[model samples]
Target: MSHECTTEDCRNHTSTYLCGRCTSDLQQWLDKVPVLVRELSVTVARLDNVRPAGGGGGGGHQPGSAAPISLDALQLQENLRSVGTDAKAYAQDSRAAGLAWLIQDWVTKAELLVSGPDEPPINHAANRERVRNIAPAMPTRELLPWLRQNARIVVTSMDIRNWARRGKLNPVGREPQPTYHPHEVINAWHDTRVP
Candidate 1:
């Protein structure tokens, strides 16, 4: 009796237990396993490098104390193990589900490692540049006239002050009168006026 291919997603009938097409697909996935494992190993090594030099005992070593492992690192390690196990299972059974799940989990772990908060701390300079790019900074005194001329809307000083109090407008400098980014003020004005 003819048997169907054992690999998931394969529908070919085969005289043998497994068809050649399914066998090739399984081999391709198995080949990728080692590369993924190597990538995960590199991420773990990078995490190790960033770890604190010693257990936080304030320069004194405590007995039975070791450096604390990051929770992210531990999770990545667990994912690596799961991938390895599933890859083996996929190899034996030629089941696409196991390898697909392993790939998805590996991708998640890699993204966490690459994008963890510690690296490339917030860029204040870039933020300033972005604000400048959005609109030229204008003093509150100049802002009211500019808005009336450019935005075709009349805004009172009290309205600007209220926007500042409400956190809709962020002032750049000293109080009593502060500079503002025109784009932000314009957006806030539009938002408030929306019925």
Candidate 2:
């Protein structure tokens, strides 16, 4: 069965975790990580260098800073790992080996995101959500029946109209036949249910 691509704003279908196009994009981005790692390694090494003793220092010139960027780099790594990665952030400045390490770490994550784990569980396919439109928006005609059957709740088209008018449910599909994702409708039903 097909699964909808998880990449934001991308609406592609795939048999794997990510669609082919997204996977290719991720691979291209991953290509830059190694070169960056090499550069950061050099920078970190240079930062580790010590000043020669008595090199035109007559008065006060204590060995400036002991690894100035090292603490910052460690903090940056912690922050980077906390939020995960975004395609847009790849172009941002990165001068620390810590950032490089996180970037390199993405390779494994990319593999997991594009495809399942090396040895997926036996019930992986059964647990996966099959594609049926990003969230499967149903217009009023289809929405009513689906809610009755799946949610086991009664809702009139007029009630749907009122909810839309009152900002209760937002339509995912636009225009004359506005459609709402079933989950949204189910949520509204639950909210308005008495006891």
Candidate 3:
């Protein structure tokens, strides 16, 4: 069966993988096209016959000749500008194409690395969420009934003096008493009973 060539400019396939020499030459051409265009533009623009020197005159000569914008020098100026613009655009587009090829190659290599013969299983977000929801919530009030049902008893009291000294508990305004939420106290008791 015939296959498409990897080179974007020439996609004709002759039953081989881009023919090794064409692949190498294509890479070199793509690499040098931009540099060549840039240097050519600079050299063309720098020619003494192109840019006007000293006081501005028609095509760098005394007036009474063709206007500077209409002379051969002006044509060279426009050509240099066109070449530079085209080169920059070509370079950007070629880079994007190269990156896409690299990404495809990496993904294929990664797939091969995962398992030689076996196909990988598909993963779905909904099944992952279902697995996450199986755990039960541990609430303090629920434990109180269990402890009472089991005939377990424990004595506990807040050490207000030590708590206040350590800044662990804040005093009710002007009352010199530290306040504890009912749930927090129950949770602490449940910890001692359970663990």
lDDT of each: 0.62, 0.54, 0.40
Model 3 weakest 10-residue run by lDDT: 83-92
TM-scores, all candidates, are 0.34, 0.30, 0.22
State the displacement of the C-alpha of residue 24, model 1, in Å, after optimal TM-score superposition.
2.0
Off by over 4 Å in 3: 3-18, 48-195
lDDT of candidate model 3 versus the reference: 0.40
The CA lDDT at 70 in model 2 is: 36
Q: What TM-score would candidate 3 get against the native?
A: 0.22
Candidate 2 stretches with Cα past 4 Å from truth are 1-135
Tens-digit lDDT track of model 1 for 22-54: 556545544555555555555555645444334
Give the winner by lDDT: 1
Comparing 1 with 3 on lDDT, the higher-scoring candidate is 1
Off by over 4 Å in 1: 15-18, 48-64, 70-133, 136-195
Quantify how close model 2 is to the true structure by its C-alpha RMSD in Å. 21.2
Tell me the deviation in Å of residue 167 in model 2. Answer: 0.9
Ranking according to TM-score, highest score first: 1, 2, 3
Identify the superior model by TM-score, candidate 1 or candidate 3. Answer: 1
